[model samples]
Target: MIGAATFFDGYTVIAIAYAMPVLAKEWSLTPGQIGLILSAGYLGQLFGALFFGWLAERIGRMKVLTFTILLFVAMDVACLFASGAVAMMAFRFIQGIGTGGEVPVASAYVNELIGSKKRGRFFLLYEVMFLLGLVGAGIIGYFLVPVYGWKVMFAVGLVPAALLIPLRFFLFESPRWLASKGRVEEADRIVSRLEQSVIKSGKTLAPVVEMPMAARPNAAQGWRELFKGMYFKRSLVIWAMWFGSYMVANGLITWLPTLYRQHFHLPLETSLAYGFMTSAAGVVAAVICALLIDKVGRRRWYIGALFCAAIPLGLLAATGATTPLQILMMAGLGYAMLQTVTFSLYLYSAELFPTRLRALGTGIGSAWLRLGSAMGPLVVGVAISGAGVHYVFGTFAIVLLITGCITALFAIETKGRVLEELSP
Candidate 1:
């Protein structure tokens, strides 16, 4: 249940990000114009992740999660009525608020509930759902978009809501959170269930500190917690990595099919299917990484995997497309390689900052994710319009290599550490 819900929350939005090429066609939008619309959703997501962090502190994780998902269901359904480009963009932004808040809130909530030694693998499993959602999106979009039209792509967003609604009913709140607040009875009940959920693992549930933080803190708590000492420096570097890497990802994923279609002159069905295949690679890779992340450790995998991703990206830029198979092998494989750290970033970034500011920390850092995603297509649009499509893709490759290095140098290792011990 945790895995599926957490994943759907991310995959639902990501599917839309991947489907931008088709959406642009229906609306007759230019690449930069499409980027602008996507940014609106991200802008909302930035705030949602930040604010909801605190909201969970005040209200309980389970209740807030329930409400937040309802927001996703309502707004995503409303998108069907979006009459034109302006309406579509506006609704999309509103929808972002719900979609964006769901994952960060869930991430914090889920992590707080699980024990430390297994935390890395747990988050990785959560990420596997994210990949599954992409597979769901790919399968749906590959078949539905061709037969029905782009609107059906958004309709598929409802599937998570249906699946999540029933499963979440059986969920319990984080005992770490309850214990911190001195809710001894409630906390004990939750912890016992969590303890039982584990059979082979002998690890006991323990909070990092005995300190209480269940209720709301001052506004200064968020602002001050993030900037104090080493935190400020860590924030800057992590944000840079998140921003730069995602810029490359969004630019490529959003435009890959269209680039293949227009630049390579492939058929629409063929291009969309190719895009689905490329996205499927990301799903497979993300799942594999999720399974292996704990064993390999976070630091080693992120550094090696993303660096490997950089090479193919660089090649795709330098090569001229001699054949469809060649383009798919390069562009598709490049995207697959990048997913190695895609799920890790959510886990890593949230872990980078302290709990009081976890949501805020993730919000501020992830803003760059949106910023990167927003800029990716706009830059591609410019390069395509001016220099050429080759230049756009080539530039994307360079940026990704740079992002991989930056993440390796700066982001801390969180594999063995208990979630409670994590300051960020």
Candidate 2:
């Protein structure tokens, strides 16, 4: 259910971008106008992450998750009624809040549910659904927009709103959250129920062990705590990772089809197909990363992946994207590496903060994600118009290099360690 909710969130973020080429032709929009429309949802996401992240810390994850899903769905419906770019932008920005708010809290919820030993693999398997959502949007747009039109794209979002009723009944609040709120008895009941279900399925439970920092901290953890004392550096580094990764990932993925059609003058079907292929490449990379990440170690895996992604973009920048296949091959590889880092960062972000501030920290860090995501398209637009397409990849290459340095120098290894021990 959590994965499903997040999948919707992922779909909401990218669906409009997929629809952009068609919308631009119908609405007679300039590249600047299209870029604004693309950035609006991400801008809204920045507010949603900061707001919902804070709300989750207070009211709890499940409630915030429920609210965000409903809010975005309502906005999706609103988009269908939009008659122009301004109206569509309005609907998308509000919708962005719902999508943005859900993921960080959801990340915290999933992270809290798993033990650290399997944390990377388990959480990433779930996180992969978000990428699948992106791919799903591309697939849907490829078929639907050219045939049925753009309204059908927003209509796809309505499916999750129907999910809200079942989500409330089927999902429980986080146990770590329950414990942090000092409802230890309630937390124990939930954990005990999970254990019973595991045993009922013919698996023996592992022996429980307590860590030195197992005791819960104060429940009333405010936003200030994210930047205070022990959290300061972690907060800064994770924010940089989120910002740098999304700026490239979302910028490239969201704008690829539109750029392919508008600039390269490919047929609509062919452009959308290429976009779908790019998403497929990322999905394949995500599976590989999920399988090997626990063994590779988070710090080393990130350092290597970031640099690997940069190399292709750097080569593309120098050589130029002369052929459509060449651009797809190079951008697809970089996006694959970026997707690995993008999904893994949630696990990394959640692990860095304690139970009290986990959602908020993740949210704030994700706000940078929104910031970068928003800026990416705008930057791509300006770069394409002013400096040409090659410069856009060149800018991404540099951003990846700086991000790689940050991860190499500052990131800590969290593999095979308990969450409480790592964060607390």
Candidate 3:
């Protein structure tokens, strides 16, 4: 149910990207203007991630999650009524707030429920739905945009509002968050219910190991706690990872269809098809990464994936994107690997903090993601307008190089280590 809810965030985000070709034509938009439309939700996401993440820490994750779902869905429906680029931008920004808040808070919730031994694969399987949502939007656009028009796409996004009613009834508050807030009895009740559900599945339950009470938080933690002492290094490194990864990932994924349609002048369907193919390839790569991440280790996988993703972009930049097969193969493969980096960052970021600040830390890191996501398309637009397409990919190559080196040099290994032991 959590994964299913997160699907809407990915669905709405990429749906707008896919709609760009039609929207640009309809509004007579400049490249900069189109980039703004592509990025508007991310801008809303920056504020949303910060505010909702902080709020979730105080009020509880489920309440904020419910509210954000309604907010984004309402904005999505409002998008169906947009008159022009300005109104569309307004709607997208507000919609972005809900989508943005959902993922990081959900990450904290999921991470709190799992043992460190299983977190990478478990959380990432959930994360893959977000990628699948991207592909779902592609599938929807390939068939719908050329027939029913872009408005139909926004209409499809409105379906998540129905998800809210069911979520309120079914979703439990994060036990870790509850514990952190001194609601130990409530936390224990939820955890006991989960254990009972698992036992009902005919599986033997493992004995619970209690953490020392001193290690467990009793007071609510504030965002300011993220930058003090042990957490400060983690806060910086995770922010860098989020910014660098999303800048390249969102820049490529969001702009690929538009780039194909406008620069190459491919038929509309072909461009959407190509975008869909890249997104599908990314999902495949992310799944593979999720499967192997525990064994490969987070720091090693990040270092390797970042450099592997960079090489293709470097080649694309150097040779120019004239050779279609080469561009498709190299760019597709690179972006696929980066998708691994993009999705796994949630897992990595969540592990970096203790339970009390987990949501806030993840939210703040994701805010940088929102910043990079917002910048990626705008950067592409400016680079295309002035320096050309090669420069945009080249910039990505450099950014990836920096982030990869930072990971190789600075990032600590987290695989197989319990979160309480590591963070405490």
Clashing pairs in 1: 352-424, 353-424, 354-423, 354-424
**Which ten contiguous residues of candidate 2 have the minimum total lDDT?**
212-221
> Can you write out model 2's per-residue Cα lDDT over 80-192, one digit (the tens) per residue?
99999999989999999988999999999999999878888998999999989988998999999999988888999899878765767888889999988879999999999
Candidate 2 Cα misplacement greater than 4 A, ranges: 213-221
**TM-score, ranked from best to worst:** 2, 3, 1
* RMSD from true fold, candidate 3: 1.5
* Candidate 3 residue lDDT tens string, 83-167: 8989999999998998889889988888998987778999899999999999999999999999988888888988887765576
Query: Comparing candidate 1 with candidate 2, which one achieves the higher TM-score?
Result: 2
Candidate 3 Cα outliers beyond 4 Å, as residue runs: 215-221, 323-325
Which is superior by TM-score, 1 or 3?
A: 3
Best by lDDT: 2
> Count of backbone clashes for each model?
4, 0, 0
